[model samples]
Target: MGVKEGSVLPDKNQQESYIDKQFLAAPVKSAVDKFQLIPEFLKVRGLVKQHLDSFNYFVRTEIKKIVRANDLIISRVDQSIYLRYKDVWIGEPSVIMDGVTEKLSPHKCRLSDITYAAPIYVNIEYITGSHVQKTLVAKNNVIIGRMPIMLRSCCCALYGKDEAELARLGECPLDPGGYFVIKGTEKVILIQEQLSKNRIIIDTDKKGCIQASVMSSTEATKSKTVIRMEKEKIYLYLNQFTPKVPIMAVMKAMGMESDQEVVQMVGRDPRYGALLLPSIEECASQNVYTQHQALEFLEKKVKKSPYFSSPLEKEGRALGILRDVFIANIPVRQNNFRAKCIYVAVMLRRMMEAILNKDAMDDKVEDYCNIPKNLYGPQ
Candidate 1:
């Protein structure tokens, strides 16, 4: 039969290879071939591109959010005297000398043995004095501090400059600039790798106890919550909450009062019920069956904190710890802890799984595999 127009013919080599393919007993691959595309990728996006991007984000966006988060500052002695940050920004690279301000360059800074940095300006509103004569003042473009500028960042003098311009500025055209020039010294910050935040990890501890841990992180706070099995009973461990608490007690404190409700929330599996029996009995042994009773029990176990001065303030200490400190990333709005309670339940279920199946626990190598890393900067 004749081949039709616009029809494709398979390559004889490809067809033959596919038909005669033999599976390898061992998986073997070429390392050079595996990374061959890296250079091409780096050509388009330079090696230090991420660092520059991160620094630029910090200067342009993250700093503003940080300022807004900590915007208000009240005088300790006089509550009425306060300062509020309106806005913040990173100015162009510059230097002040002999009552003269001049544009600064990385080359000049290197030769002069000075840091190539930019000025941080902030707009603020403040009330001066607590008396009736107190005045509200608004200020703009006030120099707050100097921040080290990453070379080739948006704020850098050499940014967006061509090779000829770079040559005039005494900068190497091939130098991928992501380091800070402090006192004429080049400092490259190594990116730090760590376990991801707001993630639950189930693993076995050195003491042979299986535990579920979550490094909860939020804009306001960062905390860790751990649910571990010890002596066939589950306990909750969180910093600032002295002494290990029974898992059932913590569940009840978060308003899961009924044992059946707690068990059902964990799972419908009968194994979960059997595993949670010891923790539930421990809660009962301590007379922490009701939510009120659980709160009161936790209140006594709370470590003394500077925040709680009076008995009225201390009354809500346990509730505050649960709402703010424990699994802090899971926000509890208006004292509603439904989400937090569910998270704890999930942690408990994961802990049970780890205890039941050794393979269910996290592998140390695998745990580090996908961790997010960050270059040292404002963050």
Candidate 2:
């Protein structure tokens, strides 16, 4: 039979559209054999593939029920597939393929998609410096995230200069010793097992401010916990482990009298002498004697002199005089001891000068000894 004119050959436009759709849907695979066209075609095709896959997955998994109601039309354009479910049209178009699936709308369809992951947590412990406490608290605003936080309170009263802020917080006007807690939304995760492995001992007096860290508890078993009280803050630390002999007994053992005169001479302020006097008397009751030895004990008192400024220099001069006048010659009488006291007197005089002329005195000792008043005296 002769072929009829205008016989319906497959619609060339439709065929071309199908092929184009296929290329757009899976550009990488579709262009694999077409080396020359692959580079340009696959570039865009690959970009749209992820979104297209996601859309396809969503359609199959989430929108399948809606599709059965005739509310959706799944169409193949060239090589690409598209869905139009009622007013919403989602697909990878042939001309634009950048891994982005479009939801066609009358005005504009934007894929405002978001994905979420799990959250993380961390813990930290640190000592607190009062000066830095407020600043550390202020840092909470900047470091965002749900994390439990804690910090030790500052141990000193003079932490920050702002007394008003400290007072507002009702923190001890003197010093507040405690820990600050910052609870987050989630429960705090503590590594208790790790913490348990290590041991820390804090020794404090009755007041509870930590004084020391001891290796073992027995070292300080008998001593009462010493707690230092400053203002209202109480600091607890381990007491001296074993009360050896009292300070006076120790002085007596070193061949010195722990008497009031000796104690006062040694820098123990007479104001506290009453409390320490009995300790000295007890040492005298032990018969550790010799006037020179007594003088030697008194020398210890002078050694601790309270020439507040330049104390070391004053101490050195006093010792030099003691050694030259009394200690150098044994069996020295009380009068000779008094004569040697002149060196201590001179040292005291110089110490007073150093305190007064601290602003002007140069490194030279002579400069410290020379008095401008004496030079200009009775002129």
TM-score of every model versus the real structure: 0.84, 0.16
Global Cα RMSD, each model = 5.7, 37.5
Candidate 1 at 271: error in angstroms?
0.9
Which residues of candidate 2, in runs, are more than 4 Å off? 1-204, 207-242, 258-261, 285-379
Residue by residue across 191-305, what tens digits does model 1's lDDT show?
Answer: 8877777888888778989999988876567888888899999988887787698889988898888899989999999999999998889888998889999999998889887
Which digits, one per residue and each the tens of the lDDT, describe model 2 over residues 83-123?
33332222221111296533221111112221111112112
Worst 10 residues of 1 by lDDT: 19-28
What TM-score does candidate 2 get on C-alpha atoms?
A: 0.16
